[model samples]
Target: MVKKVTALKPKDESISAYVRDLIEKEHRARANREAAVVYQEFLDKNPEECAAMEVWESAPLSDEIEPRKP
Candidate 1:
């Protein structure tokens, strides 16, 4: 589940700035939706390539894990 936390009003007192921020947020959301559609279409066209491309890469942090001894 996703949750949103609203930010407290900043000291900048400019309505124009607020409107600009809303516009930017809307544009970003629209772009993400469009990209999702394109990605789906690509996967439909090339399932094998898409499967290969879908691998997620990340680096591990914090070497903290319960150590086991054999």
Candidate 2:
């Protein structure tokens, strides 16, 4: 049987908090979809750079430890 999933707010959580969480989740999903389209275009234009792009993506991110100096 297929299961139906539902989002349950905590007993002590307020309505506004629940709504905010839902909105943030929706925004994150939308951003990921947009990013996928951009990445696809990049690949289409630079198929030869796939290896370098993969290496860069696999590298650990350092943005959190040190902000870019610009």
Candidate 3:
């Protein structure tokens, strides 16, 4: 694994830097997966709310841009 990572990393990059980047990416993927599970559980528990949300999700966007309130 070390040999493969060293070979795949950029010529100017250090092994530690490359490994840290890989770890950070894996961590983010794991967190996103966990969040997705929680969101799905919420959707399952709230069928009526989910149905209401689907309506908003499928609604057409207005072409007129509203001015921001000061």
Cα distance off (Å), candidate 3, residue 40: 0.4
Candidate 2: list runs displaced more than 4 Å: 1-7, 54-70
Pairs with backbone N, CA or C atoms under 3 Å apart (clashes), candidate 2: none
Taking the tens digit of each residue's C-alpha lDDT, what string does model 1 give over 1-70?
A: 1112124335564555766787899999999999999989988999886767666333345658878988
Give TM-scores for every candidate, taking all chains together and pairing residue i with residue i. 0.58, 0.58, 0.76
Q: Which residue pairs overlap in candidate 3's backbone? A: none
Which stretch of 10 consecutive residues in model 2 shows the poorest summed lDDT?
1-10
Residue-wise C-alpha lDDT for candidate 2, range 1-70, written one tens digit per residue: 1121123666677666876898999999999999999998988899777778889889888665777889
Q: Estimate the lDDT of model 3.
A: 0.94
Q: Please, what are the lDDT tens digits per residue for candidate 3 over residues 1-70?
A: 8899989999899999999998999999999999999999999999998999899899879767789999
lDDT agreement of model 2 with the native: 0.78
What are the lDDT scores of the predictions, listed in order? 0.70, 0.78, 0.94
lDDT over C-alpha atoms for residue 14 of model 1: 55
